[model samples]
Target chain A: MDEIKEIMLDILEEMTGEPMVKEDLDLNLLEEGLLDSLDYVTLQLEIEDRFGVLLPPSEYTKEELDTPRRIIDVIADKMAV
Target chain B: MSVRFYDGFEFFVLAAILSAPAIWLGVTERRIRGYGIFASIVVILFVLKDSPKSILLLAAYLAYELLLVRLLLYLRSRGKAGKGIGRLVIALALLPLILSKLAEQLNIGGFAILGLSYMTFKSVQVIIEIGDGIISDVDTADYVYFNLFFPTILCGPIDRSRRFSADADSVMPKSEYLQLLGDAMTRFMTGVLYKFVFANLLALAGTDRPYIYGVYMFFDFAGYSLMAIGLGNIWGIKTPDNFNKPWLSVDMRDFWNRWHITLSTWLRDFVFSRLLRSCMRAKLLGGDRVYQACMCLMANMLVMGVWHGLSANYIAYGLYHGVLLALTELYQKKSGFYKRHKNETAYKAVSWFITMNLVMLGFEIFAGHII
Candidate 1:
């Protein structure tokens, strides 16, 4: 589980090329407060590759990501599965 | 000059002549894409001086795959299966592809090098799987089949390595070949119907509005994807679906997932997840969950934004959904408004919104840029 988180962080850093230092879970994805959608899907794909968990299209409902903490738990759950 | 120029067209004639032999080998010997490359060779031959594009693309992919094999071998040699080196290995492998495709969209000249964009995605995806310990080992024939399969040549529903190799290694009876021939014939006819009848009848080429153009594009592309998938299916091979009801997705992310199901899944597994994980870990060290989710969503979208291209709109197009996902994440966390409302009706509505917006907007952007 820890390894998966470690892997996830490594993947996130490589993809974003930016530090996540001091950011909040519900903070806007874009520096400008409006995160773009295409980037989101790209991120989802990257997560799948890094973790080897296949995402069904239905998994990505708006309610899914509700918070950063929940997101990690979700990812952890998927990785565990 | 004219005679020399005609030399290129002459190759097509030759390719046609050679295709028969390839068919015989594939059907009789059951060689699959092993013999399919003879067809690829024909395409490459036509692209002669165009060797720069093919050579550059081929060398990069070859080097990437070879390095991947070596790293995994080394890791196994060191008995390091769960060591997490696989993540870095995949990152290293896919970086070139993401860069090259992005460069092409920027019109950086060489990035649009023929089949480079699609093929690179396939190989890179394969390398990641191999590194992750998901894929154990595959024979040479299977590897060849995965890379060189012809039906998937021009555009693709990028076949997974294991799935592709499995199909290649297996054999079907002669009756199956006849069925495939019938299916191929029917599909080819559909392609003809779309190209000659639907595309031209609708005069789809005469449009700028994405919604209108989207319909035509669907027929045009679905036609080809169908033909390819049909050809594969009949031959006792498999292909992942390239499209579902894409316009039906309720949000940008959903739309992307549905639109090019194969590419979307490939990108999600390899690229998007990494971005999210890094963001969550780096900044949110026990920070608010909603806050971190947003940060991850944003970071992910930015990479996706760039992955699509260096263009203003293409980048915006990527960011557009990235923003929505982040907002949606934030929204869901902050309010339980939609929580109790969850039912089939609500689900369908949301799905429709996402799909419709993507179809309406996506077609517009591609039409604006590509057309």
Candidate 2:
């Protein structure tokens, strides 16, 4: 879970071109304008490359993965399955 | 017989009549449950404006979508939300809109609805989301309201089922409603200035100049989009803005981000992103990101162009933008010079000028004057 969280934050940092902190996890990525629908696809690809688990595409709305926590949850859920 | 602008006396009167009660509800009760009533009224008004015969055809179309959703839900219950089933349901949802466009091309009449294209887009989103298990349950009333959300039905910022559902299910707090009201009025007045004052002036100046026509179109359509967003606010539904300083964009991708934003995002989400994902999964182009992106951008833009119309001109328009966008992606990623100078102010200015003109050319194509 911590590994997934770190990977997610790394992807966010790469996408946003800034170092992300722990507080960023609680912020709504979409609503805060840190990411967009298009970026979400790219983020998924990055996660797949890093973690080797590709969340099913088009199976989830951005809202489902709106926060870093939610993203971690999705990745963990898929990995567990 | 079609009422187009808010500036006209008739439209103003109709808007006043419709908005009065909605506003009252927003101010007093803070819970606007009249979305159904408002949506129904708009559907009726649309039919009346287009053709009374339209009501029957629209009802059939709506019934078809409703039945389609029911079938999709049933399939999910039966654990049949497989890839094939998803494609079939999406195709079924799109059929009426596709047929309508085809009929128009064939010069056949009487098979179209006023907001069929936008309605179909919403329906497909709902079906896809449901199949994904994102939307677990379907409420018939909510579905109706979603499709018929009048402010954006005619031309959309393409609100999503999940986001819109959140708004439709809750009433805003009084403070929030007041803030929304303020934003709504500001947007509405800005739209009037754009559409009525500026765009009309540009139109009267003549469209012989391609660039002039482009500016005219931006104001005209952006004006409508602003009004829709604002009107949506009045109704307590937070409609997304379609335009965002599109002319200031520095590339095709940036232009898309800033212009008719919702439609572009819709194309990205439903068409481009899906194509990209499927290509990645299938290892198409041997996992070459550039080749995959180029293919997806082309397909996405072409579909968007064809969605506007089936004519050769429209197809060309789509291809033109598709090529530009693909090229922009290639340049942004592959060129060392671009990577080095992309952030420099001078380089940025030149890129902005080039992108803005290209977009204007696109608008000219949309205007159907320049082939």
Best by TM-score: 2
Range of the 10 consecutive residues with the lowest summed lDDT in candidate 2 chain B: B1-10
Candidate 1's residue-wise lDDT over B1-371, tens digit each? Answer: 11111123554355446556645644674755555545555455455454566556664565566667666766766788563777676666666667776566666765444455566676666666665556666455566456656567557877777677766666656666656667766865675576556866666456565565777777677766766676556445768778787656655555666676776666555655554455544645474546665765665666666655666776666666667777766764466774455346877697577557655675576444542
Which candidate leads the pack in DockQ? Answer: 2
Per model, state how many residue pairs clash: 56, 0
Interface RMSD, Å, model 1: 7.6
DockQ for every model, please: 0.05, 0.37
Scanning candidate 1 chain B in windows of ten residues, the lowest lDDT window is: B1-10
DockQ of 1: 0.05
DockQ of 2: 0.37
Provide chain B TM-scores across all predictions.
0.75, 0.95
Estimate the TM-score of every prediction. Answer: 0.66, 0.89
Per-residue lDDT over B95-205 for candidate 2, one digit per residue giving the tens place of the 0 to 100 score: 888888999999998667868888888898888777767677888777877777777878787888777767877877778888999999999899988998899899899
> How accurate locally is residue A35 in candidate 1, as Cα lDDT from 0 to 100?
29
